[model samples]
Target: MADTYKFRIDHHGSLIRPAEVLNARARHAAGELDDAGLRAVEDEAISESARQQRKLRMSVVTDGEFRREDFRGAVLDTVGGFRRTGGTDKYGRAQWVADGEVKAGGPLIADGYDGVKAMAGTAAPKAGLPSPAFLAATCFDREISGAAYKSPVELGEALARIIRDEIELLISRGIRLVQLNNFRYASYLFSRGGQPLTLDEAIAVDSIAVDLTAKPEDVRIGLCPTHQVTGTVDRDAATRLFAGLPVDRWVLPYDKGAEGEADLLRAVPADRDAALGIVDPATAELEDVETIMQRMDAAAELKDIENIAVSPSAGFADTAGRAAISADDQRRKLIHVETIARMCWGNEL
Candidate 1:
């Protein structure tokens, strides 16, 4: 491993899309715009998003996942062979049935990475991929997916290969940071439905998905829960999950800064860092910097300040127009994270 990897301040991948981008998407869906035409608009929006992150002095920058309808939609959009069922999941998400063998149709996030790299002035470009666990759990159905694979486990392994291929291409393009949006873990924590894998199985699948053997030494990997997980977590499960994945950090939610939450920091392996999610993205209210600093202090008391950071609880917009917060509110929340980091770690951000 490299000596150290730290991100004093960061945000989940998605950002609120500007009105123009949304309109372009709507037009494209209606067959009013061609692929090239839609891409031009997306590229400009991504460039502007990168500039905004650089302006805020973010420790890491993303393409805002502007090209994707949802954060996890990338795999389904690029990889072929998933048959859409006219049904929705418990969370109102469109369901997909794995009926045929899957293969990468084209570049997944590399194009977006290129856009961020072009405009990321002083920050590292981060590409977030949905965890194979989450994709398999949510997309695979026992009866419908049986034609492609025997079980969701087999389907997950297949998706792991596809995602790994995408990761390899990204690394070849000089990406240093890759975060797996491992939202399925939240299912285990919150007892949500549509999850087929147990905690151990999900962890095992995640392990296979990120097994990068020859990546550069400084290429850091992280895990971020796409949904909010509040209150207490099972310490044993947390410890296994943190230590099991070969990642550099874990971005966890602490929206309410609930009692004994800081103690969960101990679950993170000493070798891995933890970025506390103190700023809530679902609401428009700005968080108190003093309260954010207090939460950071509690975490610092458990883990080294050098191994801690701050971020929004989740993406500003997992799906387009999903988050209730406006663009201005989103900026202020990110600024609060940056301000809190500066107070805790000086200019380390």
Candidate 2:
């Protein structure tokens, strides 16, 4: 496939909005805010999120996952064979993981692309889904998932099928970019710490899972891999796992220095592009364009500059309740990417 985009800057699905969403959700749950009132607030926020992305001159605009309470809640609730089993985290908040069969049910994502049009009115709307591999990796409970699935392999494949259906639905609606949110598990597989599933199988499974909708030329299929592989494992073999997949771009994470990034850059397939996560989301300090340029320059040293795009290390809102950076900081982070990229690419886009 020829390059679908020419040196553009955009974000993964979520955005950093004010605290209205979290507050509204709680109010609605407590019956203080009616469903209609909560929805009105969310709709307004989605519009604002899209408007912000457009203001940045982004090639893609996201609806900011404003409609969902948490990232995984969409698929876990709708999908068959999953029930919220009782659990809690270290924070003492009630927690739950899907414990059931991997059968199909409701749409994995409610339409953010359409929301962009009705609210923000942007032409470049990106529709993202939690990667099929994500459901496979996180939902594997032997006593729970195994009861429904013959084995872990079957659970993974079932997840791929359901996600394929969702992608096809999105493509049919003319949503062009389908971002598969692997949430860093793809890179973690290569790290020295042992991963439950084999790296080879994970790649193959994800490839089968996301190779949906339009031809690769027509659709921009992006993989958001967050972890930077560490030295405890075979970086050579692990890096090469990116070879010959249907994916169009690798939105890879880069939080540390650029020294170890060469092997990962070298591993990118000839046909695909690499989008570097330059800004660290864990901190709120705003980086100047020159700081972003430093990372771009480092990547250029490893590979041709044309194969790259730049973004933050993760979504601006790390969790629904937590904005990793202030909204102003997020805007600066995105603006720095576009401004620096323009300086590097002759100020065209």
What candidate 2 gets wrong by more than 4 Å, as runs, is 88-96, 118-123, 184-190, 227-233
| CA-only RMSD, every prediction | 1.9, 2.8
Best by TM-score: 1
lDDT at residue 163 of model 1 (Cα atoms) = 88
User: Which runs of model 1 end up more than 4 angstroms from their true locations?
Assistant: 1-3, 190-194
Model 2, range 1-349, lDDT digits (tens) per residue?
Answer: 4244663575777776558888998998898999789878988888877777777877677778787645555566467776555775453423544466566655666454566765434445677677666667666777766667755556777778887888787677666676777653544535544554566656667777777654544667788765454543345554655664577787776556555555666677767888777767657776655666776777787666776777776776635766756777778778877776678787664
TM-score of each: 0.94, 0.88
Would you list the clashing residue pairs of candidate 2?
none
Residue by residue across 1-349, what tens digits does model 1's lDDT show? Answer: 3216565677888899988899999999999999999999999999999999999999788988888878778897888878678887666667777778878878888866777988887677888898898888877877778878887788888898888888888888877788889777865554454568777777777788687877777677788853465545666667777787777878888777776355456778777887778888988888877887777777877887777777887889988867788899999889888887788878855
